[model samples]
Structures are given as C-alpha cells and as structure tokens.
Target: MDIYINKIHYPINNLGAGTRLGIWFQGCPIRCSGCVNRDTWEAGEEYRLDYEEFIRALLSFENLDSADGVTITGGEPFAQPRALLELAGFLRKRIKGDILVYSGYAYDELKKKYPDILKSIDVLISEPFIESAGDRLLWRGSDNQKIRLLSKKASAVYGRGIDRAEWKGRRMQFSIVGDSLYMIGIPGRGDMEKLYEVMKKRGIDFEHA
Candidate 1:
C-alpha cells in the first residue's frame, strides 16, 4: 500500500469516466527508450511511505470526491508484484472501484509466471514501448502494447473471452463518458476535422464536442 504519488486528473494513465488516482511507484528496471517519466527508472531514490499511510492518503481522496479508483502505475508495477498484489487485495476488500495497472511486462508472460498477481488486477496494460511503433493516440508508447481484461472467473462463467484490442499504428485516442466512447488526441486539428466529416459520411455517431 505504500504508494509514491497521486494525481487528480491523469490523462496519461487510462481512458475512463471517473476521476483517477495515479500512483507512481518508486522503481523501474526497463529503462525504456524515451520514457516520459525518466526519473522513475531508478529504484530506492525516493522516500518510501508506510503501507497504512498510503492507504490513508487514498481514502482521504474519497472524502474529497476526487478519485473514482486507484490506477497503480510505477517505474514498473510488476517489479514489486508481491507488494502490489497485497495492496490490490486490500483495496478490493475495502474500495468499490476497479483497479487498473500499467506494466512493461507482457500479459501472457505475467500470467505464466505470476498468476496470483494477475488475479488481483482488473485491467492490465502491457508491453514495452517500441519507439518505431510510437503513436500519439495510444495509451502507452507502442503499437505492441495491449489493454487486457483479467477477471478470469467472470470470463469463465460468461463464456466470453476478455476484451482485448491491438493498436494499429493510428494516431487516435479514446475516452469514456459513462460507457460512451469518444475519440480524443488525434494527431492534427485538420486531420481530426476531416475525420469528423468522414465519420459523418459513414454514419458514425461522432462529434467534436
């Protein structure tokens, strides 16, 4: 539960309807090329907060109505999988919102190596950023990255596979408004305008507003 930092409105975390609490853990190992948070690449550089203290801070945000759920991001969340798993378990028992995690490791690899860790996460965004595949619209840096759904029991009972999407190297972004989807952060203003026209021509329900 010891978290690094929290942000109120974090566009860099995920696409969703509610306010997000972005927790940047204190370490990372990949040293990804052109990392946005280069400072996090080094471990043991930042001061650590006790687990209970971190949880207290997160709960404080609930009183302020400023956070919907916790987004556990890091130098690399999986780097400290046990600590994260424990934290997520505690949150699931007390909090009502979903848990989202971002990691440079692949989902399948994590599943094989640490299924217990995967069990605690609702959504896992995986894959390292490949500079060649970088696009402005994707959540992470590369086309190889994916948003994986990890509720195995639900998937098993529903008989429907977890939702997964691949980035096709398009400069398109997405936002969620109470389950409604909106595309944001398209590369150019002119291109976005043209895209709106094309969507209209194709009868796609889209608007710039």
Candidate 2:
C-alpha cells in the first residue's frame, strides 16, 4: 500500500467536476516529448508513503461531502499496478465516490497487461501526449488520448461516444529540440492559426515550456 507522490491538491477544479483529491504518483516509462512533469518521469527516485497513511490523509478531507472522487495521476499509475490495485480495492470497499486514473499507457495495453488493475478502476484516461496533436479538449492533452469507463454499467452511460479512430488520421508529432518543445501537426498555416485562435478563445495556456 506504499505510494510515491509528486504532490497532492485538494479541490482540483480544472481536472474534473466537483472537488477531487489529486494523487500524482511517481515513476513513468514513457518519457514523452513536451512532458509537463518532466521531473516525475524517473522510475524510482521519490518519497514513499504507506498505503494506510495515504488513505488516512485522503479521508481527512474536511469537506467530505463536497469531495467528488480520487484522481490517481502519475508518472504512470499502471507502472505500479499492484499498489494501485490494492489502494483501489481498499477504497472501493470504504468509499462511495469514483476512481479516476491517468496514464501514458493506452487502454488496450492496460487491458492486456493488467486487467486486474483495470477492473479496479472506474475511469481510465489513456494514450501518450503528442505535443503536436495538442488540442483544447476537456481532460486530454492530445487527440490520440481517450477516456474509457472500465465498469460495464458506467461504460454503458459515461463511456458513450468516445472512440480513438476519430483522431487517428490527424497528423501530429511531439518533438523536443534543445530544451524547447514544439508541435508540428497542423495541416497548414491557416490550421495552425485557427488552432491558436481557438486556444486563445478557450483561455488555454499553450505556450508552456
């Protein structure tokens, strides 16, 4: 039940609706270009906390009623699937809210590699971030990413209309050159201009380094 964390933020507004407990786990295999949390990509170089203590701190939320759910983000959660499975199992037995996980690993890979962990999660946001394919979407960074509900009942309702093929044809690539990040997937200059316009309209900060 031990977990390594980058940090914790209560009442995360941008990630999802309602208040969420954001647990940023450490360690990731995918060293994605333009990765925002580059510091968290290492395999094993961070502090760890006991499972019981981590859950205890999460439960200590003062406004439990307003808390929506726990978001298990990471360098990559599936990298330590056993720990995740244990935590999710414990939480499922004790809590009423949902469990959301973010991983650079795609859904298909997760299903094939660790179906047990998949079974324990309610929602999975999968796919590696392609800086070139970046879009002003709700939760995903690139068009290739997807949101899958692993639970059948939840999938029937919450997972409707989410398909990966819709974005497969889009030309996008992530590249890092001399400590600078750049995306080069727009169909044309006009498309790039339009995307910038949309980003501005939506108030998304796309100029991060």
Instruction: Using TM-score, give the best candidate's number.
Output: 2
**lDDT (C-alpha) at residue 159 in model 2:** 51
Off by over 4 Å in 2: 43-46, 152-159, 162-209
TM-score of each: 0.64, 0.71
Query: So what's the TM-score on candidate 2?
Result: 0.71
lDDT for model 1 comes to: 0.60
For candidate 2, lDDT tens digit of each residue in 63-180? 5445677678877888778788887897677655677888898777888998888888788888998878846455666777777877764455345665432333345444565665
Report every candidate's CA lDDT: 0.60, 0.68
Over 99-187, each residue of candidate 1 has an lDDT whose tens digit, in order, gives 77788887778889888877886777788866666454334556667766666532442223323342344444455757555443224
Clash count for each candidate, listed in order shown: 0, 1
Angstrom error at residue 21, model 2: 1.5
Best by lDDT: 2
